[model samples]
Target: AVESEAEKRDRATREIGKRVMEGWRILDKKCDDCEVPMLTQGKDDDKGECVLCGKGQKKVLTEEERDRAVSEIGRRMLDGWKLEDEDCCEVCDLRMCSKGDKKECVACGPVLPPVNVNLELPPNFDFSDPKALEALLLQVQKKTSTANQVPPTPALSEQKEVDKVNISAPNTPNRYGSNSNNYPNTPSSMQMQYPNTPSAVPVTNEEMSMIGAEQKIREGWTMMSRAYCDCGGPMMRAPNSREAMCVNVHCVNSCY
Candidate 1:
């Protein structure tokens, strides 16, 4: 069905109003270049020119528009903050930062310069002043006196008492009795009790010489017993005498 002329006129008027609103809307790209608001008009031959820059540009915006654009960029940066390459460096074995120009480990990021976090010095640490030195000395003396004055604890005192008791206690005879002999100098008879006699007994020259000979023979036997074959078997004594021999001939020859 054909529309009436009055309806068509009203539609054209509405279209004109929409076009006017669109003309007022700022364009971001053109506004970035211009420091001020721009007047825009649609023409058949060319798009438009920035009133501030006079650069024939299609997009233009005001200061508020520029701020919005910067904010949007910042938001995008925050949202997409990530390492550019998932690929780790072969040498450093760390993820690279996503920033294109980054030269160091991007994911782990470059190590910041070490900050000196040492506490600031007090304004009054002068050592040259005799009064200051005297005050410090007094503090040190007080601390030393306090440490020295800390009495021996109960446990320490008890331990000292125990030690004193042990020192004062009389000596008791061994289980084998005073005259039970072991080495050459030990007494031979447990019952030959003397009231105040010393525990040790003197040995005769002949007895001492015999004991020395026995000890030498024992040591020699021990040395010969320790000799072993390549197969790790012990040396054995030969049939009739004191001489020892490794059973394996090869071991005996090598060992001897």
Candidate 2:
């Protein structure tokens, strides 16, 4: 009874092996006859033309189709062939897709590395009121005003000084030493006088005469004021009368 059971088990095992081999053959044949390129299941997927014979209508695989195929292949390899858990999804594991290579996986979406995404708080932040904003605006205005303030240019200052000098100078012919007629016809035999130094005075006869005339004019003004009337009008007082009268008799009559 033991031998018979052993024999039955052996036969069953062989049959199973044969069936598995046949199944594998069918799968291999299908793969060989497949019009799709090798790694093209996920990568290129231009189809309808036999990969080996180059026959049939061409059709390109969509991204979704490629992803599904890759996932399906990975699932089959993982479950049916008993692959490692890490190898379950080639797309997720390798993160790449390539053309014409059976090992090429589908593209998985880009995976970002773990990072510190939280933002840091700003220093001395206050957003509840307008005081801070107003202060900031004031500071900006001050800076702007300071920047806009332009110092008086040297040229402008010099021009103003020139204007003052021109206005203050007398409008006489020889005011700026241009006309020689204002001085004596003959040059005076005089020397320049320097401060704290012994020097000859350059007074000519013409200048002396002018000085004398100016003194006489002053004396005449003094005498005229004493002999004049008290009414402040330009009227001469009589030599004998203490009371003053205007030269215009009509003015005196009108006043009286």
| Per-residue C-alpha lDDT of model 2 across residues 1-256, encoded as one tens digit per residue | 4456456445533432332222111111122453222221221222222333334333344554543433333332322222122343323333232223222233332222212112222456342234653454344434434443444223211222221111111221221234323324212221111123222332222222222222222223111232222322222233444543332111222111
Error of 1 at 169 (Å): 7.5
- Summarize candidate 1's per-residue lDDT along 94-199 as a digit string, tens digits: 3333344433332122322212222222366444454654454455434433434433223211222221111011122232254233323223432122223342
For model 2 the local lDDT of residue 97 reads: 26
TM-score, each model? 0.17, 0.13
Task: Tell me model 2's lDDT, rounded to 2 decimals.
Answer: 0.28
Candidate 1 whole-model C-alpha lDDT, 0 to 1: 0.32
After superposition, the stretches of candidate 2 with alpha carbons farther than 4 Å from their true spots are: 1-137, 149-151, 154-172, 176-256
Give the Å error, residue 35, model 1. Answer: 79
